[model samples]
Target: MRISRRQFGTLATASAAGLMVPGLAQAQSATGMHSFAAPAPGKNTHPLLAKRDQNAILARIQGLMKRDGVGALVIVKPENVAYSTGYVSRFAYGPGVPAGSQAAAVIPASGNAQLFINLMESDDAPRMTDDVDVTAMPGFVFVDDGTPESRQERSATIDPLAGFKDALAAAQDMASDGKIGIEKGSLLAGLLAYLNSQVPEDRSLNSEDLLYEARLIKTPWEIDILRMAAQHAERMMSRVAQQLEPGMNALVLENMIRAAGWAEDKEYSMSNMAFQIGIGPYWGVSGSNRNYEIKQGDLMRIDGGGTHFGYISDITRTWAVGGSPTSKHEEIYDALYAGFLKGLELLKPGVKMSEMYAEVRAEVEKSPLLPTYARGHVGHSISLSPLLEDHPLFAPGFDVEFEPGMCVSLETSYMAAEGSYAPGPYNIEDSFVITESGYDRFTTVPDSLVWDGSLTTQ
Candidate 1:
């Protein structure tokens, strides 16, 4: 179901008042952002999957298909397949897996959906969602017990091509007017050739644009997942920040961040923890070096993220190592924060991303302290991708307007020259969900130049 603007406004108000939606209360209580009870167990499904509105997502896809005059979509990208079918495949995680062995989802614009997956995952994939008709293909040889059910479920061929042909025929039958959209980049050459021979070239259109368009505006369920992911990352970062002390190298800090996240059964993503000490142009460096020790007054800049379910969180913060910030340090941070706040102020429905970028860039350029400050983009959309930055970046020439239910990250950074007076990187970043009137921020850590030791005190 789509959330009306009025409903969204009320929900935003409730969220601000610390009354979060179901399935998020436990995270809120753990982070002290809100008072809530633990979520109850889901029946035969992952908690996040139980929270997802599959109907809403399918309706969105159908709407986009109707608008584009497309009939059906053959989704094969690991991320896209997961988004459409709610079945996270193990093949997407490790290396050396054949391209043809990947799972695919055949979604019709006006009817039931079909998921083509490996037979080994047949039992688990159905538990994630019951909205799709699963077609399990033979992936590995198994010594099955002589049971009637096992014999009936077994496929005749182990060839992936045979399964692809079956799925393609099914998609054609479901197509509205013989027009199908396929992800060429994710398909094997043999599969693509077969698709070409079966369907005319004009009828087989690229599904990338259509799929991305549908995913651009998130449903209410997606927003909740993003919010929870952001909170998880912030909590881990806070713990790591509190442990910072003299002589602690990047290795130590990185381990702390990983340990904190893994302890809660979450995964790290997107540079994990890119750290920089004192000065230089190593803004995106994440390698752990024992020689690069954090000194008493060194500036520490950390840009990192963690993943929840599949949503990603990208957050950055810079501060003095020992709670002692020099005048120059504070001045630089003030400039960055000013620009960040300007971006936040401009983050509302109907605002163009490029317009926001220009305004924020102008605000930061006004500061005399950062005469050399420059950036290509201030922020980007954050979601299911393994990469931190998604599409429609907050950069010049991107004219996508902010819409309610869109979640994005707003960030800006400055790295002074090696011998400059205020040397080192100064940065700030946070995630937010665009609302009806304004935006709801995800991270709650204070934007301070010095760590207040709040985590330690608690």
Candidate 2:
């Protein structure tokens, strides 16, 4: 279908709004936030994703199965599917299909897992995903009224759950112990009920905790892919800021970045990005979608995440619109950076995420420029797009210690006090992963704004 530039921007901008960190009413004020655009989808797979280590992923799942006595895990969540199978099928994810397709993975007690796919994705499965035992819904002729001669397409076009039963039947056979696992959080009640009915007993139980526990930590290959995503975000931010002109609307930056990413991919399914102007709560087009023209002396906050191989790279930086930072701005940034830097240092293996949050809050409180709307925490895990963690930030957790492979976003968020001469929200963010010793920073963008109130090169 043909879409006008204006319409496309509106639709895509709505999608990118999902990247915003949930909190506050996201109330809008006079100033605004920048909306980020994502690249179109690409068919050519990246080498990194094409070579994802299947054994490492399977081992983690198998280890959990052995310990929990789970005969199999019916994986449906897109992130979990990708993590387990190392596949990047477009069929696995789509709008409105939040937890992935109606399909599920029938992981047996041993050997390769059975990947049940929807009719629409059956053909794309073999070409796009990793080599695995792929069972797709049977294709049938799709008759359309537009056929002058015969506008009909035949392929896997039958029942959406046709292939699912096969996998479910297999799971029923393997789950003799009557203990199968599924992501309770992601699956709907109807699906869960159906799954239970399919099995001899109500054996399916929530197992997302174990799955995330394993995925929280990154592998060497995954880290590299995340790094590539980070670089893309950094460059996109610079490119957007460079082209900014007075009176240009907030969407200008978003569209520019979108164009740049579109050069790489056309379908923006796997990527996420956002920008915020120093418009207090009313900033960035991310949540607001307002059309605010640019002005000098305004602040521009670039909060974005680049997706490479389906991994996310989250990074944030702020700039003074006129290319000159006022002393007040510098003062606020200094205080924010100090606490955030120390928080990064505290990210060592075995260190609980809660301890680090307390330490950071204490440090930030020490600054005379006390936070006005501070949340008394640092940040959360930067998992696959739209699938982040709930804790390890904000407050102490259930003794979940820092592991060597989990990627997280180190950030400081606070709005200026009413009386104080503060910028909109005093914030900065970057992505990093805990290492065996300390941490490996995936986002290379510097926290400091240079003399021009902009970053030159980091």
Candidate 3:
């Protein structure tokens, strides 16, 4: 199973298993946007999507269209592309981060959803999603290669400009002479130049914030998928904990987690995995090159994650190399844990991100285990992308409020012991879904620094 790229906390607790179902009264097209009403909750509208809450989805689309000073949207980022079309991108930009990929989703304020992709997925991409119309670009195909039986996909080669002309035409139709809202941060300069060549410069703007804000709120169906994703994340984390030993290489552990996920029947479209390896203080973000070793007392922190069902899970856990966390280890964990609890306690609908950060930081500052500096949100809206996505990051003036169907990570970290990777902070993260009253957690890992000492010897 492939891991697809794919949060916590209101103190108000709800049954983690009891999903908060919302009744979407169809796509309200009163504002002249695409009106799509998802199938009733608990439905299999597509191969992977069990719920197609069109109302929830259209609400986001409407939000983006209604962004002040914006008139239309061109969603090209992998995260947003998947969000609208349910077409998880198999495209990889590599370490160099290419300027553009041959994929996009053109969403008009008052029509249908148009998903553009490489030629490779043209044949079956529509089968992977619901609602949106799929348009595969030219010159590539989604393939599995490098081996005979049960071959694995390396990646698809793309003609950077393929189908872009047609895509621009679609965007033009959506824009309908309105200011074109492009993904400025990601819709590369080349693409932008091309788009600008076609449209009036005065009629374009960066609508990243609008798209992000729209994506922040999840529908009941999306929440269910996120919940499943979190469980898969815990399984991967548990594998690392269970197989952890004094002599295994980081590569081995990486493969172990991947295998464990497949063993659990987890399948995803695109995902990446990297971890900080080596003994404490020497931690470095190492790949699975098979060189780094895990010493008896090394604190191996996995700062990176992969995807599941096109939705990435942001779960970080620092394990004591030999298990049975020492008092010193516990102290560091406690400091970070303080923020986790405070984040949860203060997390309710209408609560500001700034407020959450201030309160959580107040508690985190109480711990001597931390360094002098601290920044970032105690929690951030999560879905599709794992980092500070959906305009996440509780900085000053982030006036957004927690809303139902929103998911976030109750994230916290600290510098346990410094060395080559001086002041490397211990990473602790989990997922939660905001609901009608409280929230629903995705990961079930224990929230304490303590793990059974006996597991070290397993």
Candidate 4:
């Protein structure tokens, strides 16, 4: 458990090498197009895990239900579904998929978990899951738009609210008289309204409060995967920084980051990437903007995240598009870095998340050059998805405690005064995790305003 700095370095190198193996070999083959599903058979192919890690996850859910005193736990969130069962689907509104029926995975309190994936995604479920068996065996329950009979109902024909009802019914059969603990905030407005129709006019259904309190802590297996993901994000950011040029637009910069994540050993690379970028005060800019160019003086902030084996790595780096950093930028960068490190020092088992935020906020407050933009604390725990969707962000009243097994993002940023005539304000951010004794940076970008060759063409 005591991994020395040297051991960490060795482990990092070994991990990087392991990631590169499948990535490099797959690049030469025709089927390399397959995303990070189960690797096709190859020399020493890793076994596709089947129902091995279910006990811990199931136990966690059962305990959560008992401690919370809920008769049935209804899991509707995609991330929660992925956590309970290793299956992930492209349920997002994209391409040919209908905007509605967004593929959903659900686990009931007492019965089999079900996945309502489009026919296209049924096969990918098993390959993606480590445990929590899907009922349809190697395939998921396909919901086609064509008919309610096939479950492939179109977004228009089969109401998602109805599907939810059916899922609840499946769970209801297991515990008919007990209070059902629906994952609060998870049911869509329409679905909630529909479910209300079925409830007796006199009865109130008990829904579970946000379930992420238990999920805030990561397990060793989860941490290991996150470590790999962070490495990929860091290396990708570094490599992309090396590729940035004066004229490259947001789109190009974003692609470079994405490519680095997928450029790993082809076998374990990500299928897609998500990002945001900006030069001025606005921190939420994103996507491919081939036209907007990166100039020499632009304070480039690229916030990117990548996934490996479904686990995610969220990272951010703000630096000069070129190698030069304005003194002001450096000052802000130093403040932000200091805040991040201070938070890292405070991050450990037994510390409340709010306390860590307070530590970072206090550090930022002392910086003469920084703004009061230290709105919240440094970061929060991460898992199979980005930002954990709607979890707390270093705010008060959130009493979640950090534990050794959890992976968290140490994100901290400062709003700077607008340059005399520049676009506006700017900020810097990054991510890291609490470790057994200390912390580990997921995206290993150097905490400096000067862009090292890692992200610049100098």
| Candidate with maximal TM-score | 1
Q: Which ten residues in a row have the lowest lDDT in candidate 4?
A: 43-52
Off by over 4 Å in 1: 1-43, 96-100, 141-164, 188-191, 264-282, 286-291, 415-421, 452-458
Q: Candidates sorted by lDDT, descending order?
A: 1, 2, 3, 4
Cα distance off (Å), candidate 3, residue 93: 5.4
The superposed Cα distance between candidate 3 and the true structure at residue 172, in angstroms, equals 1.9
Give the per-residue lDDT digits (tens) of candidate 3, residues 330-426: 6777777777788888668888888888888888888765544366555667777734344676656777788877888777765544441234347
Q: Give candidate 3 misplaced runs (Cα > 4 Å).
A: 1-46, 67-71, 92-101, 140-159, 249-251, 266-279, 288-293, 371-373, 386-390, 417-425, 445-447, 452-458
Maximum-lDDT candidate? 1
> lDDT (0-100) at residue 354 of candidate 3?
83
Q: Give a tens-digit lDDT track for model 1, residues 25-59.
A: 22322333433345455336655567788788888
Question: What TM-score quantifies how close candidate 2 is to the native fold?
Answer: 0.78
| 10 residues in a row with least lDDT, candidate 3 | 21-30
TM-score of each: 0.81, 0.78, 0.76, 0.76
Model 2 CA deviation exceeding 4 Å by range: 1-45, 89-92, 98-101, 138-164, 200-202, 262-281, 284-288, 371-373, 387-394, 415-423, 451-458
Q: Write the residue-wise lDDT of candidate 4 on 90-180 in tens digits.
A: 6633544422245554555555556555456655665555444543311244555566666643343444454455556655564456556
lDDT score, residue 63, model 4?
A: 70
lDDT at position 222, candidate 1: 85
Better of 2 and 4 by TM-score: 2
